[model samples]
Target: MSLPNDASEDRMQMMTKTERFSKLFDELERCREDEQMQKMEEMNGLIDEMNEEELKSIFTIELFDKIHQIIEEKTLPLENALVLLKHVGYYRELKIIYLESFDYSLLRERMKEMIIDENEKKEEINEKILTDLCECYALLGEDDIFGEVLSIIVPCLLKVALKKDETEEAQKEVEMALLALGNIGYWVEKESYGNEIKEIIKYHQEHQNLTRLAYQSAWEFLIKRFHNYESLEEVFVNDLHFAREARREIEELKRDVDWKRKEETGKEAKELLIFRKWIYNIDNYFTSCKLWNEEVEKLLSSFVQMIREFRDNSKKVSNWCFFSITNAAENRNVKIDDLLKSGAVDAFSEEMKQSTLEDKIVYDCLYFFLNVSRRLNEKKDDEKKEAKRKSIKRKMFEWIEEGYEDVMTSFHAILPDLAEKSKFLQLSKYSSDYLWSL
Candidate 1:
């Protein structure tokens, strides 16, 4: 009654795909420790080869429940388990199961244990674990759980962020912690943790010890959580107002015709130095948000004045002014006419003539010109559609014509050297290509 070889082969081919997958799963479960990794790899390969319908049919709720059980028992490393979930395209389902099955408490307890153990060892925290834990809590969005997690995670993050004489690895840890804090900031109850988080970030923002990258992360966190104009306005403008008052006093003193008084005023003007740093940090936020209404108009006007007046005294402030204006113009939210009338064109043109200016400053100036020129070209393209458009284009064209020669002369003088520098090569290439096209 034994089957022939051909008949046996036919019977093996007749086995359904799901039956084969089930055999693989059983083999994986029974595999020895040394073979488990190989089995998982094969499973992943088979899963990839299966079509969506086949996958759906094979990966049933029962199988998922088994996977969850394995995860809870720590049969596999957490990262490896998460990766498997990702490859299987079941991360969302897994998230839902975890949220609904009261598994967050388990995750929370694990995180707390890990933090305590690391602290006891006086070791750098495991950033990857904390990041994953935070991401899970963020997705769950349960306020109480989020608050508890935040309370634990924030202290650990601050410890890293505030570490003295940190190693390179510790610096990286600080970055990861800040990024995680930012991601977690999106889910926490603003009333309870918002001000607390802001205070921590503000400390970093004003702290002299932290790197620029740290300050940037702090600002990004604020922008992510509180995106409104008023919130940002309070952070940037309140301090800026004091700086502006001091600037005005310095300006008035410049016209005093008293050499002694002017020198005294120059010393006081140096106080505005800190404001320049704050302005540099917040300018991109202002430009990206397009907070160009009447209130910010004063700020923009002040920038134009700063470029004209402080160009010789503080190139840093001047460079930032050009950057803010360039960003605003690039977004096309600020009117080109307003920028032209504000003497931004003249200021930048003058800066371009300075042989000793930083390549970055010159790059910003050229970028501003490139943006304006591109905008002008767009307006010109629209001139054919309407008479009113033609009139506006004509005015803009005339305004640019007045400055066109000087701008191009500056561009030509700098293009050769700029095209050679490694740091500015890409931008210079872009500028060269755009100028040639025109």
Candidate 2:
């Protein structure tokens, strides 16, 4: 069913990127009853080859307008038009994401015309075409003219999401729209638009229609707007959905039995890492806010559990948790004592023996200790806090006394293996300062 690697390469070698892209659409346009699905798959595969020259070269405004004229003048299928635009959206480069309101209007109108109105004005909305358009706009976030397109596209996406209970088709459309909104969420700068997104995220999540990835994407989208306004931060303080999303996802991962077996290899591994990324992001969002509330406190506690539970799972999981603590610590509000109280030091110490920690972890751990020593130094003259500092230092010493120095030694011993001198120097200073401070 799949093209062999060498054959795929040979096919590629015969055509330049633009040539291949142009030809794919030409084939898609004339493709018949027996070959549609295969042709679609081939078009989807072109996502990898998508770039500025190939896209701009193939779809000049004149060419695009001509296609529009043809679609209107003939009873032509509009699927290839949306498919081409979807590929254009997939080209992630922002400068190339040039949008024209006329182009947007044309696409929307053509999709409407695909199945025309009749008596009772009976209209059949093509969910599949709508799906492609939702995705295209979602991926086309923050383009030069995206602000203009937002008023046009955002409402359409929201209308789909609002119809969540109407039909199975609407529910599927809701899920698709939520994800599409998520793709463009962070780029949302308008408060009205951001609030609309925030409420939609809440509604779908409460209805149990939201996935963890979609939920994460919604917040990531909102943070751009949320960060600039105090009123927005109150969204977190007043609501529990954000924390519930984190807790629900973490609990699911822990309960995922198929993901736990040591010998397993599949999507579980990739998905676990994705879960970790989502957690890390929300974890940072909690810390970034100046306002503290129940959601923040609860999620921080959840993060602690995330580190302690998954530390021994796998190197990837271990490093993932390591990154969580390291990143969370960037915010001073994520107090060091809380991490220690949750056994972060003991958790990391377990990872030090016979464990292969990554270089980035080594970097963060070094600065982490530097920050710790500085905190200790801040309280050095306070006799009242002496016992507290010592008690904390003792836990840290266990990580080093157990196997940390050896880990550091191995890293420094092969310093030349480092590709960049700045990184080498930074690591060198981090190591030297951390050891000296300890």
Candidate 3:
């Protein structure tokens, strides 16, 4: 009698759990049919109530297939479909299902229909859905599909981004759109869409009401898409403007470097640090590109002068200046004669004498010297090439003559370790051979 009663209680408990699960599914169905946020929230609550084990048991592939079928049938609103997708673990479960059964045409049509439908409801914009759709298309890795989606959505995003009298909510919408476009822009062919995207971003940047976030996103998109100097000329020009400002600030800070070095905790020091970062970023930009014009030459010259003045004050600034010189040398933009004439070689030698010199600084120095050697080797006149090589070798020895032993000791200690890293292996070999010969 006791065993029968216990079995009866166990069956009742199972029935109660099943009943609760059934009610939750019914609520989900209602939410799917009527795209109501409140119902969606309640559904989320129900999903949250279940532990991981219970969730795994209840939200199985069979139910997921049913939701996918509902999405296919177009009976449920997309938002509601997405909500159901989220409940069933959208990224974890749905992504696997879609990727395994990758249907390009079906997904493309659905995306097109959704965008067209959303455009029809202009006042009631659903940018989140659209952004998510862009992300989804990006993940699909279908260039044509991504391009098609971008073509449709970018204009709409631009419209929002360029809207007059934008409220805060509208601004947020524009930001979302720009971010999505940027993400999509990274994968798509730049030639097809870069100009239009740049134009939209330029408008956002020029607008007084727009936030810096939008401008920055647009700026990054432009930089990433267009690699040519002509296309990036505007950014270079902006960098020049900032560089000018920094130069002026650095001049002001130069007067106080002596006072500030002692304390290194005042407004002057702070301002100098900020200016140094600006200079580093500016120099890095020039280093990254093949912008070897007269303007860049002038910039390099200014950097040399800055190095000479600031060498005693800031190691970071000095190191960046050396890096810029090294990069210019490597690119064959700054000739060895000009670099030596600018006192850059002397400055590099001085910096190397410091015990606190980083491995990167040593590498840059070796890279610069290697580039100089290569340039000399490339000369048509053998006599002139040998003469120039001997001159550079003599200059290197002269610079390190005071602490040659110390510099060689440091090199011996660091070179073996640097040789183990593939990037610096060649430099390590050349420097080690050069030092031993010297």
Candidate 4:
């Protein structure tokens, strides 16, 4: 006798999720070519409905082992497995299962084969498949994995980063590849790939070659590789920013603000804590990079522009921007020549002459001036280096002479603050003296 409808529905609801998912895997294993997309859609539907606990419970070692077997047998498409893996890739437990189980070398070989043909093809789905694989490798990249990805993925990312066209697929390709490179870029061999990496870093500086996310990721890779130092103070200027916002937000919540605005404020505060740290750290790291002249100049241009538009982080941004540039200027053969070539002298002269100057900004500006000024005094300079240095100093004087009175008056306006701060920065005192002489 068949059970009544209510009883049958109750039985279906009572079935264990593992049993249900097991059957779903069975279907995935035998899905026909025409049904693969629909199957993925269905799988996503199921995945969406699963709670965190249920999802976590479902992705066991056994499940990954089964998926691994399917991949080895070519039952499920590699990309499909990757799509499934990505859903739970954030869990450390599951990530290890993937790392240990997948025959990565074979997987890479297969992907390379497909992509070779895929280059000439315009299939978005193929691009998506390649993209998904890249994410999996990026998410799973540990020691050896990071090295492998750095080698194979860097060239592809650079090629896409240089695409002049703005097709959606092309843009997505660039974004994904940039994000991958950011994740695994520490393994990059700076000698072999440094020039191309520089191209990507500077590619979008003058004009927009990358979207905002891609631009941030390109710098992310650069900062990650050169993160050789940390702030002497454990707390950053942004930490204070975060704290003030948090306190203000909490007070607003006590008085009751709109839920959306309150939550957004909280989110912004947290993000500020991290992303802003990244901003100031650029100064710390780039000082060590000394990528030199045009490369360094272009990056500084990009970085300063980003912070120039920062929301509520102005004081720190102003100080950090020049501090980092000043450090970057310290490297061998680096005189920030390209920046001067772009007429930084006139621009800075005008800035210093602003109606009211913050002594702090003036202090920071002094450091940048000090850095470029040192190049003019290098004792052992080759004629090429000396010529380069002299040319920069000549440009500064030209700007100064053109507006000598205004420039001198601007220097006088800050002389008191420079004297006050000189106890801490006697070197900058010398720069002040040098500027006065000019």
Q: What is the TM-score of each candidate against the true structure?
A: 0.42, 0.65, 0.48, 0.42
Please give the lDDT score at residue 137 for candidate 1. 36
The RMSD of every model to the true structure, in order and in angstroms, is 19.0, 7.9, 12.6, 15.0
lDDT for position 223 in model 3: 51
* CA lDDT of every candidate: 0.53, 0.56, 0.54, 0.52
Q: Which model is ahead, 3 or 4, in terms of lDDT?
A: 3
Model 2 regions lying over 4 Å from their true place: 1-26, 41-77, 81-134, 140-146, 204-206, 211-213, 227-231, 257-277, 291-314, 379-432, 435-438
lDDT of 3 by residue, 168-193 (tens): 88776665555445434454454565
Per-residue lDDT tens digits for candidate 2, residues 82-141, read 555555554432222344432444544443334222111336555555556556646543
Judge candidate 4 against the unseen true structure and give its global Cα lDDT, from 0 to 1.
0.52
Task: Compare the candidates by TM-score and give the number of the best one.
Answer: 2
- Which of candidates 1 and 3 is the stronger one according to TM-score? 3
Model 1 lDDT tens row, 12-71:
468665666676566655666557666666666565555445666765655656665666
As a whole number from 0 to 100, the lDDT of residue 281 in candidate 4 is 41
Candidate 1 pairs with clashing backbones: none
CA error at residue 148 for candidate 3, angstroms: 3.3
